[model samples]
Target: MELTVDERWDLIDKISKQTITFGRYSHTLKDAIAEITVKPLTGIPIAIAVMYGFWSFFGAFAGFFTDGFFVKIFDEHWLPWLQKVFPGEGGFLYYILVGDPTADNCFEAFGMLTSGLFVAIGVVLPAIIAFYLFLIIMEDSGYLPRLAVLIDTILHKIGLHGFAIVPIVLSLGCNVPAVTATRTLETKKQRFMMATLLAIFIPCGAQLGMMIEIIPGYVGFVMLYLLIGFFVTGFVLNKIIPGRSPEILMDVPPYRMPTVRNIGRKMWMRVKGFLFVAIPFVMLGVLLVNVLYWWGVIDWLADILEPVLSAWFGVPKETVGPLLAAFLRKDLAIAQLSAIEMTTYQLITSVVLINLYFPCVATFAMILKEGKEGGCKSAPIFLLGSLATLVATVFLFGGLLHLIWIILGVA
Candidate 1:
């Protein structure tokens, strides 16, 4: 005996009524919070407030560790001992290991053991810790899913739906896994577009951490500018790219107090990866830069690109080396830039360009792999073309930002 659809629903309603009960109250605390966080009017502002708090805390927390502790220990004790032990007043090995040994700070020294370790442990690690802590809290509390829901309409305007937020969030951790996460999207177009945007706009945790340490007061402004660039680039891509963005269909989990053990475990894993992966790359970058400098190749390239680097980007000619290093590791690239002693405007422009230039080697390979597996067999050509376009776009954007700053008398 088949029941009518109305009868089926009526029976299910009766079953639910019998099975479920709430003591007097109609709603729980979680329900009330969800009601506010999923709404259009209040959700976006709350999201912004939360993000601002995250960064604010990140800046302070990292600064406390860096200036209050790491810098003091390294500069006052470790660096001096290392310098004394490896005293080579003007030798080639000395220059490579401890750059400009007499500089006031490790960052300025640009040494393998000094600047390299200082950047990884002193500067970047603290910021990474802060970011992961906040990220874990949000993830376990279920705020991220609601934030995604709240931004669904806005995302549609940018050629992606709320579902794309998963990869976007993941990209903040590292772009390689973010690229791999693109497989979750249904369409090839979305996968390609998201992968492209992630590579161009999102600064991974390590890069952001180092930027916060190096740029000091201007890190917030630089980040805001990059975010604006992300949205504008997305809007333009939506207009140019020929595809329809699918609507989001996601199940939001219930809010709960995050487990301390889980958060610690996750943070440890991420920090461990950063320590092992990022430190080697940073040390390699220092070695590579010193080698290139000794060989005079950096000077030759700087001379060749002086027209573009200096006249166009408003940065020093030596920025060519950092720009090249950005492809291998963005944190190292930013670390390299910190040693250059440029004006605030130049630093901001260089940071923006490095973010928009290209993905690190790992992410680049992941993009190619994902593109091929996702059926875009011409992924290599497409990535190269996208990279070229990004470089041109960033250069223009950087110049415009510098011009605006100058017009406002801030430069």
Candidate 2:
């Protein structure tokens, strides 16, 4: 016989109140679920707080290695000798040897792909490892799901469900992984919208590390403003672009202490994955940049890129080198910026544009996968969205700096 509605209600209430003990705590599973799932604000804040803590720790840890080890030891001693051996002053071998075709000195090769080994090892490796460490912890903690619940209402207004939080948060670590994670979502519309946004605005770990180092103190404020612009633009796009918000229904895994071994393994796996892809690109990019310098291609390309690069972006013509390398590896882009001379305003604008522009190649593949899974057949929309955001961000940040410079009489 079927139970009456009143009987079901009574049973639920009883279950909710029933007590069970596990380890040092005791609570009914039903009641625990209610407390976590129903209180969106509480759970969300806890999740975000944990995430902030993790990243802050990572930043400090990575900065230690970059400054204490790589910068102090590698850049100070090893690079100088390598430059002497390669000696790129006269012959064709010198061009390949010194890492730069046009330069007699080693420092110039620091900007080219040859001496870029120092850049990759000194800056990118430590930072990427730290970022993945934080990312993996967040994943294991099961906090990301609760974050979705917390932001569900706001996300709904933006034409997305709470689950969209997964991709957006992951994009901070790297848009590639975030795009891949979009498969967890139930709807195609949700996936496409998220993929476009991730590719367009999310600064991956490598780009972020560059910003932390190269962006001057005051202009760091402007970087914050740029993030505001990212969110605002995304919100507006969510409305103008057609899509239905998916309903939120997700598992809130219990909070448990993640095993040390598990966290270490996960973090290492992510770092290794990135290195496997990044190392090849780093070598190829170095070779390409060095060859271009030897062939006069860099100067020619700089001349062509100068109109947009210097005039519109307010960055020096030299910045074109790093900007070209940005597609190959963002860390190199940031490192290249260090080789150029620019005012604080120009530096901020360039950094903002670099962070906002085209995602790395690995990220593109993940985005395409997300798009296909979501049943959004048109890939051009995601590509165009990313490119448009790039152009708009460059103009916006550059214009903001121009106004500031004029106001201060620094222009």
Candidate 3:
């Protein structure tokens, strides 16, 4: 009456399955509760507080240079020499080298260029460094996995899962790295979904830093609007796209404080990478826009784009200059907005539009890389979807604000 070998194995398999259920069922529920609570409540708040503290300190440090030190540089050397060297010859070179100094458009002066650099180096750089440092610390310390687990439910609604946090969070520092971080996602669908969201809605450090400059006295309110936009657009994307949220099996690396050496090296590498890659694009964007303007191509292009930009978005024709730069670098677009005068609504809209605008060259490359790596045959969907979202958001928000203005009468 002894069982055969096959019968014995079947008995073992059944017992194993039951044993697994008995052993792991409680652990699963406990882990779920722990991950979710940490992500939305405590984890997110800690991240925000860390962000505020880092920025507050970084701003004070950057302000010293931007307000005091860079001012001296402009006053002492850059402005006087540029004026002497360029000297009253009203040509394109004069205009490019020394932007209208008198705060008027027609005159050739060094103020705009100086102001732009100070904004770029003194303000943007410090914030960028500090922000990137915080991100690296979070990433290496392994809190990111819990963050992913915590937000999995919300992210799932958008065809992604908790792991998408890596890219979305990094997008705050820079879309380029955020896009690259998509490599951590297992499936092509997840990467594409996350990448599309990152490009359309996430403002990089430069963009946010620029908004800090121009948003003017209501930064808090503008930020709240942006947060609302992110969640709304993300929620809509979840409903519209047909896909299951990928399994969230992130590796929770051990929670240890990031070492000083490791943190310094990480920050240095990120800063160096930013400068090497981003600065050239910024300078080139500046050069290209100036050349295009000088040659009248920019004007022609702006004329063609004017109706859509002005009527729909309520942005001026001059915005086309910054939009052109946006394709090269998202930060540059935001930084460029500072040169122009915009109402608070216009400022917020411009920030949102620029954020939701075209992906940078780096992000485009990352998208292509991810497509290749993830075996996604339908990669173009991300690009198209992102563009659609950006256009829709701009128009929708623009219309809403226009109605609000009509109702409110600009106070």
Best by lDDT: 1
lDDT of each: 0.83, 0.68, 0.68
In candidate 1 the C-alpha lDDT for residue 234 amounts to: 82
Report clash pairs, candidate 3. Answer: 101-109
Better of 1 and 3 by TM-score: 1
- Off by more than 4 A, model 1: 1-25, 409-411
Write candidate 1's Cα lDDT for 199-309 as tens digits: 888899888878877777787787778778888888887788776777757898988899999998999899888888877988888888888888999999999999987
lDDT of 2 by residue, 9-87 (tens): 9988788778643467568775575476448556666655665787577668778987788766655566565556655
The predictions' CA RMSDs to the true structure, in order, are 3.5, 5.2, 6.2
Worst 10 residues of 2 by lDDT: 98-107
Candidate 3: which stretches are off by over 4 Å?
A: 1-48, 75-77, 101-116
Which candidate do you rate higher for TM-score, 2 or 3? Answer: 2
